[model samples]
Target chain A: MLAIFVEMFSYDFILRALIVGVLVSLCSALLGVSLVLKRYSMIGDGLSHVGFSALAFAMVLNIAPLYVAIPVVVVAAFLLLRLSENGKIRGDAAIAMISSGALALGVFAISITKGMNVDMSSYMFGSILAMDNSDVVLSICLSIMVLCLFAIFYNRIFAVTFDENFARATGINAERYNALIAFLSAVTIVLGMRMMGALLISSLIVFPPLSSMQIFKTFRNVVLSSALLSVGCFLLGLCVSYLWATPTGASVVMANILAFLFFYSIGFARDRMKG
Target chain B: MSLISCQDVTFSYEGRNVITGLNFAVDKGDYLCIVGENGSGKSTLIKGILQLKAANKGFLTLGDGLRLNEIGYLPQQTNVQKDFPASVWEVVLSGCLNALGYKPFFGKNEITRANEQMQTLHISNLRNCCYRDLSGGQQQRVLLARALCASHKLLVLDEPVTGLDPVVTMQFYHLLKEINRAQGVSIIMVTHDIKEAVSQADHILHLHNKQLYFGSVSGYMNTALGKFFSGGGQDACNLR
Candidate 1:
């Protein structure tokens, strides 16, 4: 069994799948810290729905869905920012409005476009099984940019995520930093849509961070642990999905959740024992 | 030179004038206290100073060489911040970002400053504590330590005494007074506790009817309006 597993890891498709999974997982883990800390954990889920709408619209217009979805999700990301800043609508409400409306619009578009054939199951779950080289390249590029940006402004972004006014007072340029984060979040949502899909993407973004919070003592630890956990989950889930012939996105999401639960329970037990 | 000054600053929310023609100033090292009824725009005025709200019309100036980043502010109890999952150390270290002369990540110097402030605030025991696990007073003290870390020159606080018992409130006030006197850092604190502000402040800023009465503590005691407010009179005190 060990030899079979080792052999499978060397196969071209499997290697590509693992790489894509790890890259996307790291992206989600990096962004998840800010999102969860900002109490905007739902941002990924909402933006992914917008990605779905853009994908459907692109399908109707015969344009590349990734190209169309990028602008759409990024714009929706900005809209959420604008509304929340307008000081009338809070983050969660803004996310709800965008997510529900985008999902509805996506469904409506898919219903109307007769010639635009889509595998609904693939959209509902993810179609990581069907990724081409271009999709893999996009994931790697997006993940690298996202990770690097976080690295460059890790302190300022962490401060802003936790407290905007404080970040501003510290000369962190809260507005620009926040917008930059929102932009990256949108980009991640759109690019990751290919692998995680709309319905199941939110879990991938959240569980890794939640799980990482368990044993991590420092902020950097929490973030790094989350990234590592995400990568591990994606690899395991990819292999399991392939072996079982199950839906790829759902399998990966479930894998992440299971990993989260496992770590969460261990942490919980440790704390209880200390008591 | 005045450390901070606001001239004829009026602010409105949703087109309703919350404050009009409000004016006040603080000299270097002056401990200023603000007292007002609810909606008298105490928070609004502070928010204006923080640039959280734009005044309808006003000029705000910091003294020569006083960078905006040099100012440290603690806001009133916020539902948004209270639930955040951060540690006491994280909360306090945030203060040094203003003065660390570096980016967000802290080095040895910044950590040392954070640790020193925590000890000074008598919250060294809380260094590893979860912010939510602490009592309200403990949390406020940690936050106060954060403000202390920002720079020892100025601290602007809005109703910082909230969620504290009177004993802790006294301790908090004494700590502020010590910091102000010892470090020569000016303090501008907003509070509705008129009696306490009367005794504690070197100067008092009173807000009523969209106007201000900025003067000495004794001057505030002599005002008929002060008497009226302490009497709990219902003369637009809450509305203003």
Candidate 2:
């Protein structure tokens, strides 16, 4: 087992995947707590679909996918925020409309251009070998920035998520912080889509916080546990993928599912014991 | 000078006038209760005062050094908060976010304020407990502590005791009364319970899509609008 683990790390592509995966997991977990609490968890799913279309367009244009996809997804995220805030289109409805539209656009772009090629399939389903050195460097820088921003604005984010109206009443710019959250999610979705695939990226933003919530009761504890759980699950998923030759994204999601169930059972038992 | 003065303020929601011809003033250390039936625009008026919504016409002014952000607010609980994973300490500390300005983390001063507010609400023991795990009354206290941490001058509460049992509701009311009397914080509360409103508040602003009556509780009791709305007659007077 030790030898196999060593052999997996020896592969350069695997090493790159590990580094990026861990960072993306941490970012998603941190943001997921706020998103889930805000009832905006579907925003991640919506943004990933937008990212898919943006990546398709970038490929057709022969440009850097991150450059095109990041801005496009960020814009889509802001648009979704505005649409939901306006109340004309409810949040879930707006997300559904935009995600399905973007998904259709992505499929159309692929059909018109690559016509279901290996590269397109990799983007849709994810491939561990898809990330190059440049992608790795970009992901690291952006992920570090996301992490720092979250840490710095931690209190404000907490205020916004817990009680936006109260936060706004107290003079905190709730809208701005909300926009900041949307912006960060956009960047993280784009960054993770390369490895996790557009279809699976939102699971990273959803599952860990939910799992942590089963066992932890406080916001800080839940956040800390979610981060730890996300990273741990990602590593375990990577090992599973390496050993069993399973898809990395599916393996990671499976790991998250298992963790959620484990935590849920413990919480249920603890409640029963207390009763 | 009054802490807040409204001169012919009218608020509309989506081009429909919810509140019209609103004229009132809140003095420092005043306890004013806004009582009305549903869709009577009590909430719209509250939103107008909180600056969450703008008046379609006229002016609303804040005086006595009351900035817009300094009005502590205890809004009705949303569905999201019912299951939110937050500690009493975290929720209370977050009330200081406005004062935090560009600071990334809470300073000692903010922490002390949160602790003091928690103590004041008698929930210091529950500081580490999950907000979602608490009783409805305890959760209201936690939120009240958070609102207190935000501003010392004024508090705006919207139907604060909506779902609690009678005992907890009375306790919450008494707590608010104490905060108003002892801390000298001005309070503008919107309540469906007119009996409690008349009993606890010095002033009443009765609304029915417009300002039906706005004056001292004694003066309000004399008015026909107040008499009619408070279930009429001798029982209304007995409430006070």
Give the candidate number with the greatest lDDT: 2
Q: What DockQ do the predictions score, one after another?
A: 0.38, 0.84
Per-residue C-alpha lDDT of model 1 across residues B102-209, encoded as one tens digit per residue: 554678988998889888888998777767667878878888888888867778998998879989899888988898888888999999988788778899888875
Q: What would the TM-scores of all predictions be?
A: 0.91, 0.96
The true-versus-predicted C-alpha distance at residue A99 of model 2, in Å, is 1.8
- Identify the runs in model 2 with alpha carbons over 4 angstroms from their true place: B231-240
Summarize candidate 2's per-residue lDDT along A1-275 as a digit string, tens digits: 78998999999999999999999999999999999888889999999999999999999889998999999999999999888788787889999999999989988998898787888877877889878999999999999999999999988898889888888788778899999999999999999998889999999999999999988999899999999999999999999999999989889999999999999999999999999
lDDT of 2: 0.92
- For each candidate in turn, the interface RMSD (Å) is 2.6, 0.8
For model 1 chain B, give the 10-residue run with minimal summed lDDT: B227-236
CA shift of B179, model 2, Å:
1.2
Error of 1 at B177 (Å): 1.0
Compare the candidates by TM-score and give the number of the best one: 2
